[model samples]
Target: MNAREVMLTIPVVLAPDDTVAAAVHKASASDLDILPVADATGRFLGAVSKADLVRHAHDPDARVGQLDSADILVCHPDHPLERLDHDPMSSVPHRTVVVVDEHGRLCGMVPWVNWAVDEARTQSGHPRSPMEVRTLSMHLHWRCLDCGYLSARAEGTPVRCPHCGAEQSAFALHTED
Candidate 1:
């Protein structure tokens, strides 16, 4: 199935300028790990997690700032979902990526599970657990050789980096336990 066929049509989101308190309310109400952050025009900015706020809860000043990811990790809505790597043990089960338009407008989410289930439905002509349908993700886990930051520019294929641009292949892959 195509990405558009399995994409999440409506996703709850918050504004970038929204306060931590507001974000807390939304996440609590939804009972989800992460919430998408949008701009005034409903353009996706980034994601804010409950853990993110809790990490800074001790610091009373943390909530005063934007409730958005400092460095946003995003994916296209039209991309294939079977290409994601999901760790079931992780707190957030989101192999799904937040999708945005070319102009950066919030569109929808394409979850890895949806792809599997949809594919199973197509191949088997019946519903099958997404877990049973497996697809190995080819994404390279890149890390900054200098500072130890995970490179978010896809798994492989070198490109001019923004962190420490020393050619394209400077950063190496980093996998965490």
Candidate 2:
């Protein structure tokens, strides 16, 4: 699957004119350590990180663009995740890679953890599980019959439901379509 297909679509974005304090607030609210910075035209500019904001805490009034890192890794939506390689020389340790469109507009963010998971899954010789394949293809949702807890993840039924602690048999797959 492509990076776009698995990327987080609703990423927290910071505007270039926004303040360092604003970036910190947004990052904290979103539980993200880093946030993508975009221009007024919705074009991807760079990223502001929690560490950077903390480093510039004395200057909270500074614009995010002034403190944002321009050396962020960016990939196209259609880029193959398998072909992505980590750059050891990256200026900032990246938790997520920015995904942009042909026009350089921000689309989504792909977390490194997702890539690690995919790599492990592939190396296990199990390929993609039926639930994973179905969810990726059809965007199916898995529901816990015992507690009615729903999840969009396609990793198949867990040994126990996260919500009700019910057995794996309590989970059923359903699609909105």
The candidate maximizing lDDT is 2
Worst 10 contiguous positions by lDDT, candidate 1: 168-177
TM-score each candidate.
0.51, 0.60
lDDT of each: 0.52, 0.63
Candidate 2 runs further than 4 Å off = 68-71, 87-95, 113-177
lDDT of 1: 0.52
Candidate 2 minimal-lDDT segment of 10 residues: 130-139
Task: Give me the overall lDDT of model 2.
Answer: 0.63
Over 1-177, each residue of candidate 2 has an lDDT whose tens digit, in order, gives 566777787457899888876765565445344578888788998886555665676787999888848344688988876566653233423346788999999998865533433554576564754322222335346655455566765676577888889776555553332
TM-score of 1: 0.51
Candidate number achieving the greatest TM-score relative to the actual structure:
2
lDDT (10s digit) by residue, model 1, range 1-177: 435555565445776655665554454444234567777788776776545654554553455235446323355656554444444445533344666777888787654553443463556465455554444343335544433345643646347556666445444443222
